[model samples]
Target: MQDALAAHPVWVIVVDYILGAIMWTLIGRAAMNIFLPEDSNFFFMRFFVRATDPVLRLFRPITPGFLIDFLVPIYVAWFFFMIRFYLMPWLLGYSVMGMLSFPLESEIAALLYQAFNR
Candidate 1:
């Protein structure tokens, strides 16, 4: 019974990886908002920056603390993906999503809804 419960972390890694994707997604949008004139005020883009800025702050040093640098978010997304897809499932025996079933389900539902809504 106790050993059976150990697999939970694999799921957590998967979800965390997805979040890492989101973090990068926001970073991409933030870059566009700063550069491209048209998408500058996209509400969701603003929201992403606001949402991820705090967490990414810890990783900012990887980018040398430069707001304009693309390296931080890009690398972060990559790192998370590696952890989620390769490391977690293959090495840990599950996925981050498997661990975070609750939020992942809602997030997936929301994504599906958004995708189909368009």
Candidate 2:
């Protein structure tokens, strides 16, 4: 696992971090929508809406019209998840298709493990 982390360039890690953040944020937005109205004016809700708007808009053309408005974030987040899980590994020249590609989460888990074990 350490060797896999060391093999990637810094930029690959940065890209993975960014994509993972977006993916999680979009999912968070979807989850939050369950408890609050879209126009609730709450800080975190507003942040989620503002941060994810552009991404949703970019995907609007491909997004299905039949989907409820609040469910859109999950739909769009799925694309980011796919890119991170599948495309990143291919870009990094991984010959195997099922290898883990989430460096950001992996690094976080490793850090947490070390912190808890000590």
Candidate 3:
């Protein structure tokens, strides 16, 4: 497991960056929606909504309205958090013990991993 990650560290970094970006985008979109009108054409707000809407739409049906209103982004973030922290490591051929023992050397991946895995 260590050798695989060490050999192809780029893959792990890419996966972690992509997941972290999406998670933060969802969070940003939710925050923007609080103050700005959903239809607001602000550049960043529009970007966030455009970037995150598809994922949020997919999650919508599973969540109740009350939870969806404020907690939807958080739920989506948590999903990605799980994927980045737990699923990816496991899928990368690391065992449970290996996961706990292997140190993530990529700084960005390591930071996000700590944020989520904890």
TM-score of each prediction: 0.47, 0.86, 0.66
For residues 53-105, write the lDDT of model 3, one tens digit per residue: 89988887776676756678888888887776678768878544333232333
Off by over 4 Å in 2: 1-5, 96-101
Which residue pairs of candidate 2 clash?
A: none
Tell me the tens digit of each residue's lDDT in model 1 across 1-118.
Answer: 1222353555664565466567557557547656554334777666666666665676666655554444555656566555555665566454444443433444566678889999
Task: Please provide, for model 2 over 42-70, each residue's C-alpha lDDT reduced to its tens digit, 9 standing for 90 to 100.
Answer: 99999998999999999999999999998
Best by TM-score: 2
Q: Which segments of model 3 are wrong by more than 4 Å?
A: 1-8, 95-118
Model 3 / residue 91 / CA error / Å: 1.8
Q: Residue 45's C-alpha lDDT in candidate 2? A: 95
Candidate 2 lDDT score relative to the true structure: 0.86
Best by lDDT: 2
Off by over 4 Å in 1: 1-24, 27-31, 34-40, 64-68, 94-118
